[model samples]
Target: MESKIKHLEMVENIIERMAKNCFTLKGWGITLIAGIFALSAKSTEQKYVLVAYIPILVFWFLDSYYLQIERKYKILYKNISAKSESEIDFDMDTNNIIITESVAKKLCYFRCLFSVTEWLFYCPTLVAITILIRILNVF
Candidate 1:
């Protein structure tokens, strides 16, 4: 029983780390975009605005990857919670777990990319970039 608890705690720690990574990625994405925006404004170069897309897209993919991993761990946590003590082998690798078809679809890369939380941050950033590009071109 104690071992099982410890195993669950380990899995929980991983989930927490993944969530933290996603948060950190969001912060970095915003900071980089803001910096790029400043550069574009100061230089009056649309190129900087174009460069901003690299970080935004990269961070978006990374954030989605972390979210996907976090979700897998959540599923693993649920599976572990339902298992017998003997079944709790303290295995933290989520890839070993057999996910169902529907659940697997939800866990895919593109699905994670378009997930509500991901889209909420990245899509707006994209729109903002587009707006910036237009403003630069007009002025």
Candidate 2:
């Protein structure tokens, strides 16, 4: 029983770390975008606005990757909770869990890319950049 508790604690810690990573990525994404915007404004160069797309897309993908893993770990936590103490082997890998739900299918890379949280943070930023590019006559 104690070992099971320890195993759960470990998994929870991983989930927390993944969440922090996603948060950090979002922060960095915004920071990079802001920096790019500053550069564009200072130089009056429209190219920097377009360049902002690279970090936004990269961070979006990276955030989705972390979110997917965090979700898998959440599923792992549920699976672990249902097991008998003796069944707990302290294995942290989430790959063995057979994904069954339609929602769980969103855990895949491409699907996660459009996940609500991902879209909420990134899409607006992209739109803002696009609008800025248009205003700058970058086309």
Candidate 3:
């Protein structure tokens, strides 16, 4: 009983840490974009958009990876917590969860990039980039 609670706590801590990493990646992405805009605003070069997008895309992919990991841990957490007392064990390994080869291949990080939660953060920035590009063309 107590051991089950402890295992659950460990799972939760891992989830919380991964969640923090996802948020941190997002914050850095936003900051990098803002820095690019500020630099672009000061210069006549139209290449800054390219410069800006590279990092944004990289960070977006990395952030999605963390989000996917967090989600997996949450699933593990649920499995741990939902177990009956008699069925509970200290096994916290999520890798043991069987994933079919097809399902595993389909759940790539690229797919996660388009997930609704990720879009909520990145879509606005994409729109802003387009606006900036159009504005550059005008001048």
TM-score of each: 0.92, 0.92, 0.81
User: Candidate 2: worst 10 consecutive residues by lDDT?
Assistant: 97-106
The CA lDDT of each predicted structure is: 0.89, 0.88, 0.78
lDDT of 2 by residue, 1-139 (tens): 8988998999999999999999999999999988988888888565767889999999998999999999999988888988899999988889887567885776778887898989988999899988888887877
| Residue 90, model 1, lDDT | 82
Q: lDDT tens string, model 3, 85-118?
A: 7877777676864455765554566767788878
- Better candidate by lDDT, 1 or 2: 1
- True-structure lDDT of candidate 1: 0.89
Off by over 4 Å in 1: 44-46
Worst 10 residues of 3 by lDDT: 97-106
Candidate order, TM-score descending: 1, 2, 3
**Which candidate model has the greater TM-score, 1 or 3?**
1
Tens digits of per-residue lDDT for model 1 on 1-139?
9988998999999999999999999999989989988877788455767888899999999999999999999999988988899888888888887788999999998999999999999999999988978877834
In Å, residue 47's CA in model 3 sits off its true spot by 1.9
